[model samples]
Target: MLRGSAETEAKLRFQQASGPIMAKGVEDTAFYTYQRFIACNEVGGDPDRFGVSVDSFHAYNAHKQLEWPVAMLATSTHDTKRSEDVRARLAVLSEMPDAWTRAVQRWSEMSQTYRKPSVDRSIEYHIYQNLVGAWPIDAERLQRYLEKAMREAKVFSSWTRVDEAYESAVQDFGKGLLTDQRFTADLSAFVDSINRAGEENALAQKLLALTSPGVPDIYQGTETYDYSLTDPDNRRPVDHAAHAALLDEAAKADRKTILNRWNSGLPKLWLVVQALRTRQEFPECFDDRATYEPLPSHGERLITFVRGSKASKKRVLVIATRLRRSGVTDTVVALPEGEWRDALGQRAKVQGTVKLDGLCAGLPVALLTSS
Candidate 1:
């Protein structure tokens, strides 16, 4: 108050304090507190609400296109509780709530022997959700994330006020899961069984992020499937050299080859590279002035839309799947009369009413452009 004035002092104080308060409250504290479904515990996400309708999604995108056309559209980031692909895998759980409930119950029973005093049901539930979301995770990585999560929850343990015993017990219980043969095997079996479905969702998500109304932000290592958690974990460095090699190999690989090897993450990289290239070559289709219209599909399973204007040289069509597999849409969209080519992976051409099965050709999503 001595330097400037009371008003200036108050303004400076608010500016200094507001940033950390909201970040700690919303991004760290509240996100962990409302961990009903751990997948939705992402930054700016709600755990209770499952998902939005196709109509709602289009409306939101339309609004974004009109208002904030150049804003960065990001799915995963440093602040995300879990990476995009992690959420994609966990999303599969929503489709199988009954089985997931039973699995979580059995896992809790199995961990009873190892779980510590402070590791209550709530803690166990959050841990199980992470286990399912980030499968094939190493003991060390999961332990690190578990510690971060426990601290963030601020329930029994936290960063500011250290609770060594509680955190150690939780970490030990998490490590015990790897040692428990039955638990690991069951987790592996279930994760492997539904992996394809998760991949389908991941592909659809990746496509939409890249081709949707706003500019896509491909986080490091997310050009492929990334199952990371928030902060220091998600901040791990990417192997750009290896990714460069995959991009080279993707050119020669056929659609089935890429789709079949989902674990290699080639399909996602392929989609990203192709989509970006299309956006680069035909900038008009994705620019601010471009028109966005939802294409009519028979069912609610498909997210279908096209972008372009009468003045633009090319029109881009984006078809992505949701809540279902690729083969569900054997024949769905009836395109506008023109010569259309799959601008993404798998070079395919068609005109008039086209089967999504043939357009995507067994792939979960498709991006087409008028020639």
Candidate 2:
């Protein structure tokens, strides 16, 4: 071969051999993806956004209506870093940074002994937080989860170039965490403490996704509490029987009973069923050219909007909340003058501007339809 051809071929071979290094190059992609707000790092989402404000959210939806009109509004996907519930729990940290900082410090100290000497403290700290948020509370499940998490994190080890020594250390850490009763107890208590707020955030997100100006989707078994981690764990077999039973129960449930099941995440299912039923019954209300009027709310924590069709003269009012455990007392959303009835339940007429405190009493969301 010519001298130049020999050198070029050598370089090409070197590049081919360096494929593993090329793969490792994207390891920091996780950091670049979620450095702003970890919540937006999910598949198909812009990771640079810190968080979506109510106005920005409405604006985005409006733009979509004008442009795409059929965009997917989703909370969780198969490849999400953490499940939607975990992201919801993490979002709560924004409201309580002090509490989160303190909790992280306490959990790190509590689980310090479980960390392998070879493991970095920073990575260990992150692992504990994610585990607390998405932990399945099962030894085997958590073990598989930690292994995958540590590998994907690529801090101490990676899939392309496995560091058996470090990987073994991580496995050892997981085993120790499971065996240590004190560690397990503290972790469970911490998770339980944050889980209630997580539930609230989850419900609020569900309501927003379903009522927004796009087609809402419900992943399999998501109607119930899906506190899954990621991948195969998130892809666990769903109990359709139980879901069918819950749907049956939700169908028979009165508004009050359904509201009481909000914590169980059944109310979200109920909201989905009711909203889709309305959309199916009156497809014209969801037309791209239909009017979308965002109702003015008294507080930043509440988002209210109305969907309507001038041609068909149909309207649907949606009210959903945000933040953790926020009260709706004294908060009001302005509406078009008409008779709007709670489509999810009783047909009590709502007229003019309505006070959310009375309307959304003990409910995570409200769906009102025009008569």
Candidate 3:
């Protein structure tokens, strides 16, 4: 799997094998095995489950162990089962089984009258029929359908079948009337539920994996938002030219202020650049013996942690927020009672107990370090 562009083959092999093996002094053979097991369990019977739980477990565990100084964590990969947001929302189903079951029933009820079976109509076929025939579809069956769809979508495009890719695409569009309505309604509800549970679990897990003991790796555009989905879609090349243009524009004006005004995605790009700079400047902090401290905030939208090297013991503070808007907040840190600088803004000295008001407003993360 590591040799190929897709990790499916490796993931499958890792799951099928028994026990664990040693790989490059990093016990990954065992880690992969456990991860697959957990992933399978997390989505027992949901079409959108897609093993995100397993991915998260692997990331967190890998970070806990100092073996992989940097670990690449992702819910959406080229071979992922579903889109990241879709899977993230699906994970919420585990929290509200009854709601998930009832929603699936409604979706099936609404989709049963289609002329031709919906595209990729294997399990959904049975689900729709069962819902209409039985009046009330079995929750277990609905769950199974969700699991099957998630797995199958990984190998087959929902809009393309064996010899009927074009035909399926047409049918998909035709069915859009009903499918779109039902899907959007159900998915919106699911997203709302997930947001209520707090969007921090996934984000926090990613950051912990990134800055903790392991080698932190980022999946192309994931630093900004979750774009979970399978290959072709996930593998789509980033528009570096477009991004470069935005960067240039922002740089010409007040980079930070311009970024704050732009609603597109310049802020995210800026944050990624800042994170990269932080990693480059303070290699020692991420190397070993770093401490983690969660700050107290009113909204629970901000996450702050500090890492430092053991030798020089220089500390770098990271302040990350999940809020959609910008605001100020107070954070307490155990720095050496001296002036600290904001690395992203050219070593601007920050007073005691810094206020992160406009630091990363509208941005996903803010990387700060001591001078």
Candidate 4:
């Protein structure tokens, strides 16, 4: 009757019923179960999309230039479920799901005694991974975070109707398990392994955000390692004095050495400052209409590309890796015909064919300018 409605009352009834259905149809169409990847679960992003190929990324950039040139390139936001670094760490697990499953089992066995009867195994797995990715977390902080997560999950507790008993049980589990000496030690060791590989992923993405075609936004205190969770954790105060002191120290040192050490997120901060400086100095190179050229790479791991007007003589070549721990073993990227100086590094030059093993001796990615 509503579908065939021609009468005024029938048409009005159909409109009222269909409005919410249509609206919810779009809303519910987003990534649901696929959010397990988590890295792609950002606002307006499809979590089901595993990873973008280098070729697709270039195509996306080209489209961005033609259409949404003023898009904001971002990784973290106050409303994000997990911090960028946490997602970066978890992204590695996608490539090693079997290992992740085994680790989850081991962790569950290691901490099962502390869990309350109400605790769900799936939620436990989720909590364990979040803890590992966001390690160095103090007990008090972790408990508060867990409490919030529990309420948000609304399985045992909820924000509106307080399930005090269930909330307390979850808190007890966090307090008991997270505080155990042996558990902490094992957790730290596990986090160290993930960080070893995760840091490489972090660096690659950071470089892309800075050099890719779009206006990049650096959230507060994000220049450093941001392994933060949602809300209060991500919104924590920044020690500007400390960061300023680090920036001063970095200014005196060469970019290459800073990147090699990558100690205390100095390398990331340096990259930001250098890239922003370049953008500020050469607006034409990053113009909304600038041509995006994807450079060919002989290596399977490298993603190389150039951006800017070829006639302008001011161009930027960006080269980043896709994998972690692979390092520079037998990797080579084809370069444009000209002498290019490292824009981010101190003193590195390359022409024609560039060898990653030689160029990035200790670094994971590099940005270069034609000389």
Candidate 5:
């Protein structure tokens, strides 16, 4: 910056110089080496902190609403280590650490035959976590990702001094393990066990990203259950036709239909459409002047909040389960007095204090506004 008299030109030069340095050093090196709770190891994220408290979350949102309300509120970006849905799915492990540990141990023993001398436990561990996150990924994709990952870690192999033998063994391990029916079935069963809670986590994550204070940032293919990886992988083609078809389907579908198809990614698409329309319809509620009011929920399992006020004549109430609940508990939240309707356009009215489960119906999330 000091080299050139033109400040703008000098700053650009410095930015260009620093960007690659940061990417090569931190994004490439540190991200690979530090594998403790890898879900938190995303671009612009703290690797140590697994999750945040509702109070802290609310405080951050309130601060944004009061300060930089227009900053992009991103759950997933091209720069992320893993996609949002992938992270959401992986987060279920936090709830069942013992199960996860036992599964990892079993997986390692099952695949011990495939490991070469250079293929270390650390890389194998990383592979297992990533497999759960991006389950149902093809063998080719899995092998490709493994090569990239192992190389990035620079343990047994690296991009510069490529460990061809070790990389080959890792690839063979991926292919072999994938083909091994018993191992695949075991992994699949474990994933299926946590799948429901993962879906709930994904839904909650979706709503929070959309309704949080700041301009909501929607990444490509993220309107659905995107189990994507880092760049080039995340930037892969999205099916706009399918998205449009889902939107058309959502237009005529009833609330029951909306709540039934979490697996189809229709619910996620419905959420995006409704949340965006709400922003467009009620600009005042999301503007810099809008108020952020945190509401209290019974049992505190739900992170409840209202944006905007009566003075604005419109407000958005957002609700999402804070923890994974197996069956709906008798949770309740106090509501603003008026005829409340689903912002997702479900034909239902709510008033006064309402049971949380009844308010959300079958869904783990609720988006409402009042007339």
Candidate 6:
């Protein structure tokens, strides 16, 4: 069975790489073929399966107004090169181009002291400096960060065969950065800026993708902020215990207010789960046949779309905000007259047009679903 399976996989890979004729002839033909075979053979579906490219999926969503129900949209994967947090932070750079450029220039200037070193040495120094400078330093946080860095360093050192000197330097740098309070604050600010930018970008992408025509798939642990660097970090075990503790604390206290005021990420996870549950319950409303009418907002921060069956008498309008830095209050959302529910807050009312000032209020995503 193993031999046969291997042979089948090899054949499928060959077919996939042969030419566009075999891979792109039909919508997801290549992928479906592999999935069907895996199912028949009782093999678990490949996590690395090439279901569809992001570009192709987005294009399909744009073109097919009636086919939203069948398509799935996703952003992150175990095989992805960067962590979602990193991507989100990077996305902020696009919004604050000058800030990003300035930050990079600062990093470059700081790194100039070691520029003449060999490639391996330079990379080692840079990684060490980044880890040391960026790690948060509360006792518990420091321990966690150190353990993660040490584990990753071991893996990286082994994989890259970095010289003993470089490894020692990285370790020493980390130790110094951890012990020195002065450097910690400066480094923390820089790291925080990168993280904030990344989070903003990620949130924007999520809001846009979720409200778009296709079904959005949430990767594990993406609901809250994830700041891992590469594969193992991205795939780190979900800390259910910590999450439970957080939930317990929230239940005992006014967690929502704290989260909202501090921009704490706990609410984002809730929002994602709620959105998914809502989407699942109202699958008919998001069927591929539904039209996608993008509403114009005064700023790029707002994105609105309406989805409904052409044959059905009812339609659902979804308005989401991509704003991260600014607060929106009593903002008006224009929709065809009827009643609507605030999917994020469960606030409901009847009206053709509604005001949504504090609804989005720094939240990464907000949904207004009409019945």
* Candidate closest to the true structure, highest TM-score: 1
Worst 10 residues of 3 by lDDT: 24-33
Candidate 3's residue-wise lDDT over 184-298, tens digit each? Answer: 5664554555552323334434444455555565666655444333344456677667767866754454445744554354544455455556768887777645544433443
lDDT for each residue of candidate 2 in 153-258, tens digit (9 for 90 to 100): 6666667877888877767776777788787787777677777777777777787776667777777777767877767788889999888988888787878887
TM-score of each: 0.93, 0.85, 0.53, 0.87, 0.91, 0.63
In candidate 2, the residue pairs with backbone N, CA or C atoms under 3 Å apart (3 or more residues apart, or in different chains) clash, namely: none
Off by over 4 Å in 5: 1-20, 297-300, 309-311, 326-328, 345-347
Per-candidate count of clashing residue pairs (backbone under 3 Å): 0, 0, 17, 0, 0, 16
Candidate 6 versus the native: TM-score? 0.63
Q: Global CA lDDT of candidate 3, please?
A: 0.46
- Consecutive 10-residue window with the lowest summed lDDT within model 5: 322-331
Tens-place lDDT digits, model 4, residues 63-109: 98788777888877776667777777777777677767777777778
lDDT of 1 by residue, 24-91 (tens): 88778777766578787766776667798899899998898899888899998877888999899988
How do these models rank on TM-score, best leading?
1, 5, 4, 2, 6, 3
**Highest-scoring model, lDDT:** 1
lDDT of 1: 0.83
Ranking by lDDT: 1, 5, 4, 2, 6, 3
Candidate 3: Cα lDDT at 164: 51
- Superposed model 4: Cα runs more than 4 Å off: 1-35, 297-300, 326-328, 346-348
Residue 233 CA error for candidate 3 (Å)? 2.5
lDDT of model 5, residue 75: 89
Candidate 1 residue pairs that clash: none
Q: Which lDDT values do the candidates have, in the order given?
A: 0.83, 0.71, 0.46, 0.73, 0.82, 0.52
